[model samples]
Target: MSLPSYQKAAVIEGTELVIKKNAFIPSFEKNEVLVKVIAASVNPTDWKHIDYGSGKTQGSVSGCDYAGIIVSMGEEVEAKGDLNLGDHVYGVVHGSSLERRNNGAFAEFVAASPLVLIKAAKPLKTIAKGQENIPSGPVETFEGASTLGVALTTIAITFSYYFKFDFSKKPLEDDFLLIWGGSSSVGQIALQFAKIYGIKVIVVASAKNHHHLKSLGADHLVDYHDADAVEQIKALGKNHIKFGFDTISLPQTNQKVHSAVSENATTNSLLPFNPKDLEDYRSDVDITVTLAYLAWGKNTKVPFPWMETDENGAAVSNPGFPEACKTFFKVASKALNEGSVKHIPITVLPKGLNSLNEAFDLLRHDKISSGKLTVRIEDSA
Candidate 1:
């Protein structure tokens, strides 16, 4: 198949998104693959980059999660035999990145590192005509597959590496895992992963989402609006929560989650927060921040200024994160294939690339909740 020289993309222009019909089709590096993007999803970071990322470059594509087919690959990727041309895969790219300006998932085609990509167990099933939303289930559509990349990578690194969960042993009856922001994409996926590992899950989400979250494996649910939410989590888990993940990761949510877990619990946050800010909260808990972009195994600058960086402003690389992503992709793939893991529910947007501006607006104002917003590439035409 002949590849196009240019493609339509949602490009960043100084804190705003512009749909560009003549964006260059990015070329792949030796360790990367060029994907023909089928569908792409909006993430909080997508809007955050435009809103708060001072380092973001103009003309960079503006999205992260994508589901697509491998249209081309470099020699190294082809030789590795792990990924191949025409394989259906879902993964993330550093969208609106300051360094890799042109490579982002919101375009018709993307140059993405293969290390963080996950091959779909089966071919993507097309969404029926006029269908706007896909209910949660095994990943059978590109929209559903598009939501898994960032969420899965975060969970993989958090559970397998940072938290050091021993999946080999059966979870004890008293073992518990606490997830704040349970209705968010990452929190929803984490609930299923914990259930598969036999750990009890206490998730904090709106009461209205409890029925859906419970179906996804949440053992207990506490509404974050309640004044005694932390106490409720503590009571339900009996103070035996061994692991905690804060998908919201704001200082207040972090403090609440910190207080709800066991005294010596290992906790992770999606966003970086200073331990000093939480000095009065607890001293014995272990807290680490997980940035999914590190799974690319590249030295890059993080958008947040508070994060640790080198003299050059590049965030420190985690040498083991890429390997951890590869390892966890295998586990997640197996679960997805066996129908044990379900993708987050998704709402497909209209007019494809043109809808990205609206998507970003929704994300920017926190209008989207309990599901993801996605766009199909073919619809852009």
Candidate 2:
């Protein structure tokens, strides 16, 4: 396979990424790989940074969640398991960040850490109790594979730390979870995790999406637009709901969630809103925020025992963040293979990269609901 000297890329200029015919593919370090992107999905985090005009240097590509074939690999990757040259992989990226500003999923090619890439369309061998290998299932499509990265990463981090569950054990049959904004991509993904772990789910979304949410294992659904939505949730989950997740953590939503959960129940929010403000409303509830990108940040250590390079590719001593991220990907892959996890329906915008501006408008104004919006960079093989 021949590689291009320069590739077409969507370059961020101020608040938008302008499609450029010829742009340099960003370089990777010792632990990275160069991928030919087949598909990419637009995430709220990508647009949030663009809306505020931060998280990038000039001329960066602006998208995340990509699926592609590995055309090449880094020196260290040869020692890694499963990944190989020519393998099709799908995972997340932090595009438009200061570290990866010049490179992103919204391009013909991308440089990525192997830590973020998962073997696409394969049966994942899951390790159960005592590390026994079990065939979970197989991932079916690139689009579905691309959707797993951000939502799963964030939710898995939340489950690992905030919920403190042991993945090796079977899920508790009596546990119940409440997912606010359940039709959103993150909410839908989290529903799968909860269901697989044997927890009953209570979801809040539009009434129209109720059937689809149920198919994804929602035990109960409450229309967010209902005047008594919070009351409905409380009625369904009374005395049993042990956890609450707020995908839409607005002030009002948080207040409503506080009203719905049991006293002393733990709630995880994807947003960075402070729990202090909620203290007056529900002082007994435990609240915490989760960030998916924490493992990729520079000089940070939580999931790992050591340090690594920051997103800038500068060498740092960190060893464990990449490994921790890899472990989460494996867990997510197993969930995906088990055939219970699915991507939110995707609305494919026209004109490829040129359609991003219009798509972003749809996202900004909340025209998109119950599904994700994606651009097909390359057709399905």
TM-scores of all models? 0.96, 0.85
lDDT of 2 at 172: 62
lDDT value for candidate 1?
0.86
lDDT leader:
1
- Give the top-scoring candidate (TM-score): 1
Each prediction's RMSD to truth: 1.4, 7.6
Write the residue-wise lDDT of candidate 1 on 1-381 in tens digits.
799899888888876788788989988898889999999998988888877887456778888899999999998998989988889999888888888778888899988777777788789976876899788889888888898888988988898888776566677889899999999999999889888888999999999899999999888899999999988988898879988999999889988888889878989998888777774667789988898877766668866674767788888768788877877777788888788899888899988888888888887788877999999988885
lDDT of each: 0.86, 0.71
The alpha-carbon deviation from the true structure for residue 85 of candidate 2, after best TM-score superposition, in angstroms, is 1.0
Tell me the deviation in Å of residue 379 in model 1.
Answer: 1.6
Which 10-residue window of candidate 1 scores lowest in summed lDDT?
297-306
- Model 2 residue 148 CA deviation in Å: 2.3
TM-score of 1: 0.96
lDDT of 2 by residue, 1-381 (tens): 877788788877877878887788777776888888876777887777676654334566877788778887778876664678877878777676665666788888888766656776562211122321211123565555666677866775667667865566765676678999998888988887777777788999999999988888899999999998877888888777788999988888887787789878889887656566664567778887666666563442222221234564443423444545666667777766566566677655556688777878888888878776666674321
